[model samples]
Target: MEINRKIRSKKLSTRVDLTAMVSVSFLLIIFFMLVGELSKPKIMDLTLPNSCDISCGPIGCFKANRFYTILLDDNNKIITYFGLLELPIQSPKELQYGKNGIRKELFYINKKVREYSASIGKPNNGVIVIIKPSKKSNYANLVDILDEMKIANIDSYSIVDYYTPEETKLLAMK
Candidate 1:
């Protein structure tokens, strides 16, 4: 039996075809990339002025009715007034931080402006908001006001540091 045994020399190849796996991997990468772009958060576009003027020059040309001022105190209180700094209407009212507060007031003002523009046969002169943060106001309040501006769809707004004498008195009071 040993003399009749025969020897075999065949060997198996170790090569593997990875084309299908590679294609699947690439497809998964593309799918994830598309999902990432779709899941991105929406952001508001804010345009800042090129100059930092304490007071707007040539106040006569400035539309008094379209201007607004918002003051933020250290205690997280907001005071909003409309019209020129030389003479604000009555006094700034206290407002909370949300849709029912500043957002409502801004929409009302904007509506009046739109009505006035229609009467004059002119396009809307968007409301200009001047945000003044007192020395003691926190950063969170500033962010919140900015968010409110976005929610209100305000187009023209500025973060100004200068406070008029009247504003100073207002902030100094309890």
Candidate 2:
């Protein structure tokens, strides 16, 4: 009699189905990209003054008495004066960088300019700040002054790189 033999076959798969994994990974990547795009930083809009040499028509030229100049020097020193340097309404004075320093002066000067303008029948006209950042001044100093402008609610301001001979001499002193 012949003996009957039973044969067993083994099955094995070397490939894995990665469709779900790939789809999930793509979904995650898209989600993170959207989140990053949505979280972008908001920038402040800076409106510079017109480049009119003689006079500005609709905007009107800023009077010397209504102008305020802040000079940024090395070591974060701030030199501020009201009106033109030649005939300053308030003489140039060194001020520290903070609330009690530049901030206070800005508030006082703004109030004074507004009052003066109102008295002169130009209630809408206000203080105009001119920021002169010297080569020696750091970027942080400029940024700080800009922040102070915002905090002071100054609507009209400009950053001028050119310095007058008198201003250069002023920065050199102390």
Question: What range of 10 consecutive residues in model 2 has the weakest lDDT sum?
Answer: 47-56
Root-mean-square deviation of Cα positions for candidate 1 versus the true structure, in angstroms: 4.6
Worst 10 residues of 1 by lDDT: 47-56
Error of 1 at 104 (Å): 1.5
TM-score of decoy 1: 0.72
Evaluate model 2: give its TM-score.
0.75
Write model 1 residue lDDT over 57-174, tens digit each, in one string: 7654256676788999988889888886567653578888888888899888777777787788866456778899998899999999998888887777889888879888887874
lDDT, candidate 2, 1-174, per-residue tens: 987887878888889999999999999999999999999997765755444422536754446787899999999999999978888889999999999999999999999988998999988666888999999999999999999988988878899999999999998885
- Tell me, by lDDT, which candidate is best: 2
- Mark the regions of model 1 whose C-alpha exceeds 4 Å error after superposition: 1-8, 17-42, 47-55, 58-61
TM-score of each: 0.72, 0.75
